[model samples]
Target: MLFVNSDKIKSKPLPSLSENTFLRYFSFAALYVAQGIPEGLLWYAIPAWLAMNGKSPAEIGSYVAVVGIPWSLKIINAPIMDRFTYLSMGRRRPWVLFGQLGLILSFLSMSLIADPLNNMSALMILGFIVSFFEVSQDIAVDGMAIDILPVDQQARANGLMWGSKTLGISASVAAGSWIMSHYGYFYAIVSFSLVISVIILVPLLLRERPGEKLLPWTNGEASKAAEKIQLHSWKGIFKSLYKVFFLPVSFIMGVAAFSYSFGRGLIDTVLPVFTVQELGWADTDYSQIFATANLISGILGMIIGGFLIDYFGKVRMISIYMSLLILLACAMSFLKSFWQNDIFVTGFIICFYILLTFTNIAIFASAMQLCWKRISITQFTLYMAISNLGLAAGAALLGPLKDLFNWEYVILCYIVFAVVMLVAIRFINFEKHQKRVEDLEIKHPDINIG
Candidate 1:
């Protein structure tokens, strides 16, 4: 019979969140990397591959739009995660493990599909499944982040998480493009599966803070105690959801989330097609310029932007960044008209990525600040879902817009979205919302309002 020293383990103090910087940062970074790989594959690599394979711009846009639906609908998964968790296995770790396993299996399945292009419908279904797992994993990760990190450290954690995600995308895009060019789609899928398998180890090894419940496999007593503590109830869950969605500051923040990226979505959908077709660039070339360079710039932006948000405050930093983005969009349009030089185009793209990355990091950090500890996963995911919805809406419309309007007109639309986003930001009162969250935490001291 297998035996373990439960007394010794129980006597030991669990590692505190701030006690180990490497463990904390590395864990968050690795999970974010796992999340980013599939995104890079579906959002960046596959679109280029499909375009190269003779898929029309409309088809590519539609494919992305359809697959992206899961991300925008992640709010549905968020509430479930918030209400239920395997406390013994770790509140969020179990979901992370499940999602990672799903990702591996989904990729493996894709590798087995002999002809994805010929079976476009099947490919899209697989894509949707992959996104479902990805977004589910994201929900768990965000919840864990809120629980573990102290208020002072959240911004830095957000930076590391986003930077790691961007780096993962860069690696995936570069590797996927090269592999697809050299070998085939099957090999690319195999490579992704292997990378994800490695990332799964991070969450598996993680342990919840000491004194928390453990799964039955770890310790029976702790699990039983965890079961007795009721954090989930239908009425309470709905009440929390209602407050998060309807509260003034939170409602405005949600609007900002939906508006902030609306323009970028339009630009992102068309840019890949334009680069490959009009610019006469190969898949690898576009990947290197757009994916690799943008990701590198984005990593820097996240780090810098995170610090700026923490220092200068979210509202101020976001305003500055968004204003710059508006100007950059107009400048990009002008450059397209007059300066067709490759060097200038590449430079502009890099600059645009830097500003975009900074803006996104700021916005996300702002969202994190708005989350209520009791239902952080649901609240944060709701904001993120709205952001994704806006992006997806823009992407879905890009194909139709392109067919009807010229490129210049599309750029103008981007500017219009930016202006609207700026207006929405004015409605959000970060300080007021933060005070309310504090008040809630004070009232519910028993809840782990991290």
Candidate 2:
């Protein structure tokens, strides 16, 4: 929905990412790609593979539920990240490096399991660990991006970052599935871990801000910008967060995002199980098809999604996207006979994913727009956590719902979520929030409140 590059931050003697547009985008995109690898493996590949191996929906749901919990709970990390950092090394870089290393270590640890199907509990614990690290890395990267990127570059950077992540997920899912099939899980985990290991080079190689340490041992001092803005206590952050987030528009946007994500989460959980069990596609085939769909969606998203969102307006595009989602759900629910046609189901999956990619861009744009920028990191993280919480709820509910209802009934629930999203956003008054924040900015002209 937005791109991020800095024209304001001038190039230094040695240079930093904030000063180098090409390196800036590359580093951000590459880090997100690293973010997607474990996500593809832990969230999509492992669960789908489990379904292929004859795991029940309830069991699979449990795994996703446990793993996804950490992401939703990551709101706490935001305040901590805001309050404490090694400013000499850049505000967020230390956390990014820490989280990236944790991701690699956690990915490697997944290989230690001898028999995954039998060791479901261990799988859940390790999955939880991996997700925990991933979210930490995610928050740090996003915060750094928010600080580094100028408004002009946000739309393009957003598309590229999203596309890179999608491509990474697609590639990892395809390769991970194949490797697990022939070479086994150990090699699959190791290979992806190795790929993620390559991402660490980015942070080590490029600085976030000029004069910031590339490593802890290097000589550098905290930038005046960092020192001036650094919070002396949590009280100020929490106070500002309360004032901004409780505003009517901000609250509604959070609700809208959650409801929207809930529907998406349901679809994600249902697809792998439904395609393999009912549609009769092999696990590897389903994985490959899913990967292919994501591959296409990623490309489309990067090429066109951002430009359209900026041109069309965020709220209008969001409503349109949600309507299509409702219609798609209706089609899937009512047309039972259509499921018999392999071409139809395949087409449905591809179309749904493509639409999802576009819709997400719009939603992201809205979230970015709603942010107060006073405590923007914490505020944005809160919105994201709410969305993730909704996703977790949807995933957790699937197994129970499947036990009680027909497949059609389950898909039709998407209508409820879509409707809920529409209603929530209808109450959002963006200008109202913007006006209030403007008042705050007037009070503190010296600060960049936005």
Candidate 3:
């Protein structure tokens, strides 16, 4: 039954640009900014920069593997974040603040450490810690967004957060590269730390609601039913873990994940070597092309793709983008062989990179939307964990494959992956998923937008 109450409807908060708008935008912006800095350090800049420091393609792969481990493992901490709160800030915000603080300190440590021969192991260890905390923050922020935001507002929130994240990433990478180029690695780290420090101030301005869960045991009741479930049953625990691990979406996405990551990891792990050894490009040249491609394409894809997914459904957009990405990858692999001059090679690289930037962002936005709110933070972490695992698996396999068949064959692998992604998207059926979500929203007004 659709319940309509004119007075009651007026009582609920609506999104706006005055006081309400300020709070919503301000708080989310802070979350994204905090997230953006460590994301840049751990995901974007570190691996490539490490390669430049004479690390082999395999070592670079290892770093990518190391950093990604936390994402897959974050399921352990996700539930705890849901059930626990600290210092009166509610469950999610307190942890987010703490995680960002830890990340800032970790980045500072990277800046202070020098003499690669003496501190190489230390740097990798620190990088691992930063990755852990960064994933922790991601868990909390994602959970908080779902837990607090109204269902009607969730779409806008997702779009805005992604858009802001891309912007922050662009700024971080661009600034990090310039600082690293001119002053050294130290300043780049310090500058990111300052950016994160500003991000921490977001919690001071926002409020978080208490957590709750729906339960089938008490006739679909939120409070009493959830309380009735066995909190520490081995069967229950196993089931929760299994539910996320064996999810239908994971299996469907896994095929695409495998292919996408294989191609991406190979390109990332080997590209710098290709650039310096094969093409003789300078460090600044590499940074400039990447930053420009990333900034423009990433932001555009997130905004446009978010709307498209909501409008056209996840499957159609992903299928289209994946095809484009495959074509570009093939072009790039061939372009390198033919174009001896720096100018032509650089142009082709940038064009190939822009295609990747577009498609990858589209993929990520779709994945985020696919997550069900009922999964909880712990399950959410596990979902991200498995996704990372797929990427790492692809990365790990890239080295041996590159040695056996050569880079061109590796590029062919990407084209194959695009085919797999398109095949998977066929199963998504966005209208059905949207209706399911809408039905849930109507039933429980406070349902999280996972």
Candidate 2: 10-residue stretch with minimal lDDT: 441-450
| Candidate 2 accuracy as lDDT | 0.82
Instruction: Give the TM-score comparing model 1 with the true structure, all chains together.
Output: 0.80
Q: On residues 1-450, what C-alpha lDDT tens digit does candidate 3 reach at each position?
A: 587777666533233222264566557756776777777766767666776667888777777777777766676777666555442344456677668778878877777777542466776787788888887787878776655554434444555576677788767766776777678777788888887877776654344532221111211112332232213333434444454334455456545655666566656656666676666778667767767666666566546645655566456766776777777777766765564676766665666665565555455544555454444465445545655665666667667776787666776676765677677767754356556545544664332222
Task: Go through the candidates in order and give each one's C-alpha lDDT.
Answer: 0.76, 0.82, 0.61
Error of 3 at 207 (Å): 1.6
Better of 1 and 3 by TM-score: 1
Candidate 2: tens digits of C-alpha lDDT, residues 265-317: 88899989888888888987887788788889888888887777667666676
RMSD of each: 5.1, 6.9, 8.8
Give, for candidate 1, the lowest lDDT window spanning 10 residues.
221-230
Residue 166 lDDT in candidate 2:
88
- Which numbered prediction scores highest in lDDT against the true structure? 2
Q: Which stretches of candidate 3 lie over 4 Å from their true place?
A: 1-26, 39-72, 82-91, 104-130, 148-163, 166-194, 210-238, 244-250, 273-284, 332-338, 341-348, 403-407, 430-450
The residue-level lDDT of candidate 3 at 425 comes to: 68
